[model samples]
Target: MKKRFVVLVIAAFMLFVFGSMAEATVANKQIQVNYNNVKIVTNGKAVTLTADQEPFLLNGVTFVPLRAAGQALNSTVNWEASTKTVVITGNSNNNASNTDLLVQIAQKNQEIVALKAQVAALQAKLDDEDTDEDYDLDKIEDKLLDQYGELEDVKIDEIALKGDDDFVKVDVEVDLDDYKKEWKDLTEREIKNWVEDLVEEIQAKLNSNTVVDGMIYSTDDEDLVEFYKRGKNRLDVYIINNYKGVNASKVIDSLEGDRYSVEGIRFSIGELDYEEDKELVNVNFEAEAADVAERWDELNRIEISDAVDKIGKAIAGEFENEDVPVEAVRLYFYDEDNERLGSYRYNNN
Candidate 1:
């Protein structure tokens, strides 16, 4: 009878120990959950839960606990429960923080909204201008052919005309051979100008009765040339078309100044008069070496000129092929005092 009691006591003790071990294992195990396409894992493994997955709304801000999500992504996390936000800082260099991610998402949304607004505004403006009645299709075609010689052989594939509307959509199909034959002689700049002029003329003809507010978008090669021709006394004036409310005189005045070259300062003038009763107007000018060095010291901060010279030397050394000649180097200095420090160019030849 005593032996039977001992066996019963031992069995009871064994069961109790096993039960405690099972409970400890359950407590130590990790839980996993998924929310808003982001995987959240607790500890090393995924947590399985049947809770309705919704964005955690706390204090008017949406947040997810970083500790729950970071382990799955192999990242570090810190939770500020007081602020109801979890900051999941990634261990990897490419990993972005939750705050940065949110900001980026917000910026993308703003850009989309802005683009939609712009499109709506443009559509409304087009609709208002469409009230004009008179539009001569043949005249438009003739003008296009005259301006763009390549378009002369182009066949009008489709023409969609709306009744009493100023604007008509015309799609043209051109023969590649004819286009190449005619347009090959024209420079890229000339081609761009031709297109812009044609568009402006067509718009004007279409909206004869309505006041149309539109701008021509084209590449200005002349502006690029002006930008490159530093330290010249004369500027080659090329105005494609006169734009209303734009101050052309002010722009011309701004360009008239002393330009810098690597060797010296070059003076530029809007207009010049020489001997034999000949007047040179809008000329780009170049200065002597002595003048440039003197101006560099006076006008520019010492470090800027040195930095520019170093860069120029590096460039010259890199492309030291016999066919390529390093002609000149120029630097434009715009410091706190002088905002319009003219561009300087260096010429070896």
Candidate 2:
């Protein structure tokens, strides 16, 4: 009988392992129990149980096969034929402290809720920062116009501001008639001084309102129009559009006294070199012999080096910020026929 019972258990185990094994049904007066599909998990991975050993739920109670429950709980399982009952024996630690597990699960749920709340608070803070950093173009333009409008003889037509850093780029448009009217009577030296003062004032005001690193001011008449740039080590200006250098000649002429003058001397920037370590400027001029020859002897004998240095410095001073130091000047003088009369190069060093 013991051997027969052992054989029955082995046969049942084989039937589970190889599901194609036929099942035996014997007529008995035992209560019928139905099984339904229910999943079992151990250490987070799914465990597939055969139909005979699978767990099921009925009448709000879960019923698991003896062997399946023993394996899941890591316990030893034994069957008793006298009472037809199965017993599971586990170590002291695995004696099924379900109440402690419930407490642990509740604590874990509370921790998850707290983590979700923290994430939501951080997201809200980020949203508030984004709102505070928004830019208002209309307000910026209004403030700019208000400050510049107070300057005499400057008719502000347009103002544009870009970027939100220590370096703000600005572009402005205005009418030049008023500015010319203010400077029309000033001598060349006085004009330069006035422009320098004006530039400082404008730069300060703009910087105070917002950090300004570069600016371009344009005029309808183009007089006193300035393109201003400030860099770590250099500042510069270029006369654009007038190939004959008419505007440049006028500016140079303004610097002359009664003894000698560069008036009516049409000139252009023949070459400009602005490499990383070298900065050079070259100017070419054409004038009537009568005008140039009036100081011919004096011109040749004059301090050419001093004259070039003064011219270079004056040109550099026009812009508010200078990054590169002007190092040299090359002058090419021509007569009425555009024939080169003389050429000279001066180095600051």
Backbone clashes under 3 angstroms, per model:
29, 7
Runs off by more than 4 Å, candidate 1: 1-133, 147-167, 172-174, 178-186, 208-298, 301-349
The lDDT per prediction is 0.39, 0.49
Q: Local error of candidate 2 at 201, Å? A: 8.3
Candidate 1, residues 187-267, lDDT tens digits: the string is: 323433444454455556565332222222113311111110111222133323322112132233343463434434443
Please list the residue runs of candidate 2 whose C-alpha ends up more than 4 Å from where it truly belongs after superposition.
Answer: 1-138, 176-224, 231-245, 248-349
State every prediction's TM-score relative to the real structure.
Answer: 0.24, 0.25
Q: Taking the tens digit of each residue's C-alpha lDDT, what string does model 2 give over 1-349? A: 1111111122244235324312443355544454545666656655557857755444544455657645665766777768554555665665457768988999999999999999999999997765444344455567666655533443667667676534556566555455545433323333334334433444443443444443334465353434444523222332332212223423333223212224333444433332223345455655534555445435544555556555555554432134435466556666656667677666656
lDDT score for residue 3 of model 2:
14
